[model samples]
Target chain A: MGRIEERFTALKKEGRKTFVAYLTAGDPDLETTARLIPALEAAGVDIIEIGVPFSDPTADGPVIQAASQRALKRGATLAKILAMTASLRRTSGIPIVLFGYYNPILSYGPEKFAGEAAASGVDGILVVDLPPEEADELRCYTDPAGLAFITLIAPTTDPVRARKILRRATGFVYYISVTGVTGTAAPRADDVRSDVERLKRMTALPVAVGFGISTPGQAAAIAPLSDGIVVGSALVRLIGEKGTSDDLVPAATSFAGEIRRAIDAACPSQGKK
Target chain B: MIRTQPDRRGHFGIFGGRYAAETLMPALLELETAYRAARRDASFKKEFSFYLHEYAGRETPLYEARRLTETLGGAKIYLKREDMNHTGSHKINNTLGQVLLARRMGKKKVIAETGAGQHGVATATAAALFGMECRIFMGEEDIRRQAHNVFRMKILGAEVTPVDAGTATLKDAMNEAMRDWVSSVRDTFYVIGTTAGPHPYPVMVRDFQSVIGREARRQILKKEGRLPDLLIACVGGGSNALGLFYPFLADPAVAMTGVEAAGKGLDTALHAASITAGRVGVLHGNKTYLLQDEHGQVRDAYAIAAGLDYPGVGPEHAWLHATGRARYVSVTDEEAVEAFVALSRQEGITPALESAHAVAWAMKTAPAMAKDKIAIINLSGRGDKDAETIAESREEKE
Candidate 1:
C-alpha cells in the first residue's frame, strides 16, 4: 500500500473523513496541468485522482466527457498520461489514483500497462467500467506489479453486494453518490447521508464520495459524513473558465485552496497532513 | 476426448482473453459461471438440440450439386445448405444458442454487431423469439450497402445504431457493441455473431455451430457410403468454416480448406487474407493473425463482400492453420465475383460474396482433381443482397 492507502487508514481510525479531487491531465494543455497537482495536495485533498483520457469513455458525465474530448483533441494518450504522472511525482508524494476506462488498457495489453503504470509512480487504478469480478481475473497480472485495484460501489448495491465489493476492494471505496448519470448533481443530500451511514456501518474500508458532487457547500456538508468528498465537475468547470494550461499551477492551487478551507471548517481537527 | 481446455483461459494454442472495459467484470463473471453450469447440464444440451432441429430449420440439406460438379469437370461437389436456415444464413445457428444461454442466465437484452447485416438479422430474429429487446450496431457503410436489413431489423423491433469510425465497417461496429456491453452488462447479453472474441465465446460458438459438420457427417455417409475427401468454407471471421471443420477435425480422411478473401489481390492493406499474409496480433478480444502496422495497430482492409472485409481471422482459424489439419488459401475479389456469377447462372443459387470466396476456390481446385474425389462446401449465406452489386458490375463489363 502507498500513501493513498496508508493515510486513509489513519484518517479512518481518527474519525476523520477524506476529500479527494479529480482532474483531467492535459485537458486544455500540458503546461497548465503541470501546475495543478500541488495545489490539490495543499487544498487538503486526502487522495488525488488524475483522469486518463480515453477516446471512448462510456461512463463519464458531460464535464468529464468534454474534458476528455479536449484532451484527445490535444493528442492525449496512455504515454502522455504517464509523462504527466512522472512530472507530478517530483514534488508531491500524495496518493495519486488513476481513473480511466478499460479499453485503452486492453489495447495496450495487461503486462505492459502494469509495468508502465508502476514505473510512472501511480499508486492505484480505479477503472470505472472494470468491477471487482473482472479485476479478479487481472489481479494475478497487475497485483504482482504492486498496483492497487480500487472498486466502485453504486447506490444500487445491497449489503451482500457491498461486502462482496469491500472484500475485493484494495484502496478506499468510491461510493457513487446517486443513482443516475455521473454529471447530474443531487437534489437532496438526505439519501446520500443515509447511504453513507449505511456504508460506514458495513465496511472498514475508507469511503470516498464522488459523482455529481460539486460546490464547497456540498463538500462541507458531505465532509462530516463521508471519509472523502470527491469534487470533479465543478473544479473542472472552474479550470475551463478561469485557468490556462501554461499556468494551471496557480489555477489548481487557488481552486484547491478554497475546497481545502471548506473541508477544514467542516472537520477542524485534522489540519496539515 | 473432447479436447478439454479446462485450466487454460483461451489458448487453443495462444488466443483469447478478457479484453474489455472493466465495468463488464461482474456481468461476464455471471455469464461465465452460468455458461459453465449450462454446458454441464444435459437439459441445456437437449433444449439446444431441440431448438436447432425444430425452430432453426436445421438438418438443412447436404445436396449433391450435379450441375456444379459437371460444370467444374472433376470430383463431385456437395453443398451444406446453411442458406436454408430460418434467417437464410449460418449466423442464426450460433445466435440461437447464445440467446437461449442469455435467457437461461436471466438477461433481457441481446446486442450484436454486424457488417453485411446477416448477423444483425439473425440476432434480431433470435431476440424476437426469446422476447428480448435487441440492439444491433452496424457500420454506417453497411447500413447503406444492406439497407433492406436495416428496415427488417426495425420491423423486428431492434434498435440499430450506426457506427462510423475506423473505416466504418464490421470492426468499428464490434467496438461500438463492446462499448454498449460495458454499461449494459447487467441485463444485456452481447450475442457476438461469430466464433471470435474471448475464451468462452469462441468455445461456445464453435460448439453451437458444429451442428453443420455433425449433420454433414451423417448426410454424407448416408449418400456417398463413405467420408468426403475434402471440406471448404470462406473465412471472413471463420465461423461457418469452423462449424463444418470442427466435427470432422479428428477424421484424418477429411482434408479441410479455409479460404480467405484476397480483396483486389494481397497487397498490404488491399486484402483480407489473414493466414496467407497476416502476422500474429490481437483484435476485438483474441490474439490471432491480423493485418497490423508495425505498431500492431489494426490497418484498413478491403473485400468485395462487406461481410468478409475484416483484417483479422478468428484465433481458432490461426490454430487450425498452424496445426496443419486445416489448409488455408486466398481467392481474389475478381475470382470470387466470377465464381458468384458462374454459380448463380449454372446452379441457380446466388451465394453471398463472403461464401463465394470458398465456392470460387472449390471451382478452381475441384477441376484440378481426378474423378471420384469428393468435396463439400458450406453455402454459408443467401446472396439476395448481392444482386444489385452483381448487376452493376456486369453492366460495367458489358
Candidate 2:
C-alpha cells in the first residue's frame, strides 16, 4: 500500500482521527517549507499537504491566494518541489500529498510528473479544479505510479454523483464542508455530520472533511464524524503572518500540536469500536 | 459534417470540458441537462427569439460599406452591423437566451463577469426584463477604464463588484465570478459572457450568438446573391468570431479569420494573442491556448481595448486553429487605433475598440485582394463605451 493508505489504516487501528496539515510549499521560500514539514510531523501532523502555488487560485480565498502569489514570486516550480520532497524523504516517513491546481502538472507533463512525484515519496495529489470527468488524463498515469488520486466531495454533490466519483477515488475523500471557496465562511458541524454520515455509508474509504475548517474547536466538532480532518487556510494564514519571522516553524508546529490535541480530546482512541 | 463538434461531453478535440471544482460539478451537470432540454423545446426557442427580436432588436442590417470599400480600392467590404443591436453590441443575443434559461431553471439571481462591461450591461438588461436580481464582476482596472459601461450596468440595476486580484483584468474578474457561483449555485445562474468557460457554456453561448451568422448568411445572399469569400471578426473570448464562423463551417468556399489583440507588440510580453503566442493549457475550466509561462502559470494579457484583454480564447477557437479551418492573426494597439479612426471618418460609424482589431486586419488584407472579392467584418459593438479611452490616447499623442 502507498503511504496515504498505510497512514489511514494505522490511524484507524489506533482509534485516532488523522490530522492533515496544509502548507504552501514555497510560501516564503522552499527552505521554510522544508523546515516546517519535519517540525509539523514532530508536532503530530499525520499528513502534510504541500500546496504548489499557481498564478490564479479560483477556489481559494484571499489568504491562500496571497500565499500562492508569495510562493510563485519566489520562483516555485513543480520540479523543484518534487526535488524538495525527495530530499525530505531521506529522514521523514510522514505521508505527503501535493495539493494544487492541474495546470502545473500538465505543464510538467503528466507521465513525468506521476513518476517523479511517486519516486519523491509523494503519496497523493489533490487538484482543486480537476473534477472526476476531467481526471482520466492524469489518473491513467498516477494510478500506475501508485500515487493516490484524492477526490473532493462537496456539499453540493448528490449521492448518485458521489458514488460515481468514489468509484475512481483511492486516497481518503476530501469533503468540502461548505459551498464557498476556501478560508471563507464557517461550516456548521451539524450540517457536516449528516453529510459525513451519508458518505461513510457509501464508501469504506476514509472521508476527511476540509474547507472552512480552521479553529481547533471546528476540528474537534468535526473529528468523530469522519476518518480525518484537513486544516489548510488556517495554517496557511498563520504561515503568511509569520513567514518572515524567526518563530515561523515553531509557530506552525505549535498550531498543529494544538489541533492534534483538540481532535484527540474530542474523540479518544479508547472509545473506538 | 464539419459542424459536428464538441461531442456530448463538451470536448472539441481535446479542448473544452468540465474542469471546475467538485462543488460546481453537480451544478454544471444540471445546467447541461437543462440546456439540452431547452435546445429541443420549441417554446424555449420561441421565447428566446421573442426577446431577441422585440427586446434586443434582432435582424440587424448587413450594410455594404461603400465608402470603406472605395477608400480601400480593392475588395468590396460589408459590415455585419451588430453595433445596431439594442445594447449596442452582440452581447444581448447570448444574455437574452441565458436569462430565459435562468428563469426556466427557477434561478432568482444572475451573476456574470465582464471585461469592458458590455456583457455586464447586457446581463443586467436581461435580468431587469425578467425581474431577477443581478450582479457583475469586473476587473478593478477595467472598471476604471470602462467606467461608462459600468455606470450603464448600475443603471440597469446590477451590482458591480470590482476584483482587485491578478492584474485586475478580465481573467481576475472571471475568477471572482466563479467563486461567487460556487457559493451561490443553488439559486444563482452564472451567465458567462463569452464563448469560454466550462462545457455547456461554450456550446450554449455559441448557439445563442450564432444568430449573428445566421442573419448575415441570409442578408448576404439577398444583397450580393453570393456568400462573401472571407469572414473576419475580433476575438477576445471569441464569442462574436465563433458566432459568425459556426454557420459557415460547412461552406468550403468561405474563409475565416480571427483577430487577436497585440497590445504593444507580439514580441513584447504585453499582448492578448493567445493562439498566436500561447501554449496549450487549462484555465477557467477549459483546456485551450493560454498566455502562460513555461511553468504553467498564466500571464497577464494587455490590450488598449479592455474587451480584448484576456489571456485565453474560447475552446472552439482553439479547435479551429488546430484543425486549420480558421486563420488566427493579431493587430497591435497602434494599428487598431488607426482603423478605429479611419472607419469613423470613412463610414461615419465609430466601431468599438474590440471590433477595431478586425477592421485593422481587414484594412491590411482587403487592399491586396481583387476588387471583385467580397469580405464581411463582424462589427461586434459600438465605440460609445470607448470614447474616453480614445480621447486619452489622442491627448497623450498630442
Candidate 3:
C-alpha cells in the first residue's frame, strides 16, 4: 500500500479520523516551514500537505495567495521544496503530500519531477488544475514511483463524471466542500454529509473533505462525515500573522491541537485512547 | 498545408486541452457535446446564420483602400470591415453565436471576462437581445480605463464586477469568471471572448468568427479576380486573427501574419508579444506561449490598447508559430498610434488601436512589396470605444 493508504488504515484501526495540515513551503522561509512540519505532527496532524508556491494560483483565495507570494519572495522553487522534503525525511514519518498547480510540474518535466519527488520521500501529489482526463502522463511516472496521485471531486461534479474520476483515483478522494475557491466560508454540513455518503458508496478509498472548514467547531461538525478533514487556509492565515514570532510553531501547534480536541470530542466513540 | 483539428484530448500539437479544475470538467464535457450536436443540426446552423446576417450584420463590406494604397505606392490594399458589424467589433460575432448556443442549452444566465470592454459590450448586447441575465467580470484597472464601455455594459443591462487580484487585468478577470462558472455551472454559460481557453472554446470561437475569412475568401476572388498576396490581423487572444486565417491555412501562396502588441520595444519588458518573446507555458486552461517570469508566474502585459494587454496567445497560434505555418510579428505603441492617425487621415477610418497594430505591420511591410501584389487587413473593430483613451494619451504627450 502507499503511505497514504497505510496511514488511513492505521487511523481506522485507532478509531480516529485523520487531520491533514496544509502549509506553503517557504512561507516565511524554508527553514521555518521545515520546523513547522514536525510541530504540526506533534500537535496531531495525520498528514502534511506541502504547498509549492506558484505565481498565479487560480484555485487559491487571498490568504493562501498572500502566503504564496511571500514564499515566492523567499525563492521557493520546486527543487528547493524537494530538497526540503528530503531534509524532513531524515526525521519524520508523517505522510507528505505536495500540493499546487500544474504549470510548474509541466515546466519541471513530469518524469524528472516524479523521480525526484519519490526519492525525496514524498508520499503523494495533488494538482488542483489536473483533472483525471489530463492526469495520465503524470500518473505514468507517479504510479511507477509508488507515489499516490490524489484526485479531487467538487460539489459541482455529477455522478457519471465522478465515477469516471474515481475509477482512476488512487490513495483518497479530496471532496471540495464548497463550489468556490479556497477560503473560510461556512459550508453546509448536511449537504456535505450527504455528498460524502454518496461518494462513500462509490469508492473503497478514504474520502477527505476540505476547502472552507476554518474553525474548530466547523472541523468538529465535519469530522463524523468523512475519513479525513483538511484544514488549509486557516492554518496559513495563522502563519501569516505570527510570521516573525518565535512562537510561530507554538501558535500553529496550539491551533491544530484545538482542532484535534474538537474532532475527538465530536466523535467520542471513535476517539483514540 | 496542415489540417488544424485538435486531437480527441484537445491538443493542437503540444498546445490546447482541458487543463482546468476537476470541478469544471463535467461542464466542459457537456459544452463539447452540445456544441457537436449544435454544429450538426441544420436548424441550429440556419438560426446562427440568420442572426449573423440580420442581427450582427454579416457580409461586412470588403472596401478597397484607394487613398492608403495610393500613399503606400506598392501593393493594392483592402480593408475587410469587421469594424462595421453591429456593436462595432468582431466580438459580437462570437458573442451572438455563443449566446444562441447558451439559449439552446437552456441556460438562463451567461458570464464573460473582458479586458477592454469591447467583448463585455458585445456580450451585454447579445444578452439584452436574448433576454438573458448577463454578468461581466472585468479587472478593476480595465474598468477604470474603459469607464465609458463599463457604462455602456450597464446601460445594456449587464452587471459588471470589478476583479482586484493579480495584475487586475484580463488574466485576473478570466480567473474570476472561471471561479464563477465553477460555482454556478448548472445554470450559467461562460461565453469566452477569444479563441483561447480549453477545447471547444478555441474551436467554437474560431468557427464562429471564421465567417470573416469565409466571406473575405469569396470577396477577394470577386474583387481582385485572384487571391490576396498576404493576410494580416492583430492578435490578443487571437479570435479575430484565427477568424481571418483559418480558411487560408492551406493556401501556401497566401502568406499570413499575426501582429502582437509590442507596447514598447521587445527589448524592454513592456510588450505583450507572447509568440515573439515568450516561452511555452500553461495559463487560462490551454498550453500556449505565455509572458511569464522564471518562476512560472504570468507577468502583466502592457499595450496602448487594453484589448491587446494579455500575456498569453491562443493555442492554435502557438501551434501555427511552432510549425512555421504562419509568421508572427510585433508593432510598438508608437508605431500603432502613427498608423492609427495615418489610417484616419488617409482612408477616413479610425481603426481600434488593437487593429492599428495590424495596420502598422501592414504599413511597414506592404510598402516594400511589389506594386502588383495585394494585402488585406482585418479591421477588427472601430475606434469609438478608444476615443477617450486616445485623447487622454495625446494630452499626456503634450
State which candidate has the highest TM-score: 2
For each candidate, the alpha-carbon lDDT, in order, equals: 0.79, 0.94, 0.91
Per-residue lDDT of candidate 2, residues B114-233 (tens digit): 999889999999999989999999999999999989999999999999999988999999999999999999999999999999999999999999999999999999998998899999
**Candidate 2 segments whose C-alpha is farther than 4 A from its true place:** A270-273
Better of 1 and 2 by lDDT: 2
What is the TM-score of model 1 when looking only at chain B?
0.96
Cα miss at B179, model 1 (Å)?
3.9
Ranking by TM-score: 2, 3, 1
Tens-digit lDDT track of model 1 for B296-376: 446666787888878887777888887777899999988999989888888888888888998999998999987889999
CA RMSD of all predictions: 4.8, 1.0, 1.7
Interface RMSD of 3: 1.5
Candidate 3: lDDT of A232?
96
Q: Is candidate 2 or candidate 3 better by DockQ?
A: 2
Q: Is candidate 1 or candidate 3 better by lDDT?
A: 3
Task: Report per-candidate DockQ.
Answer: 0.17, 0.90, 0.67
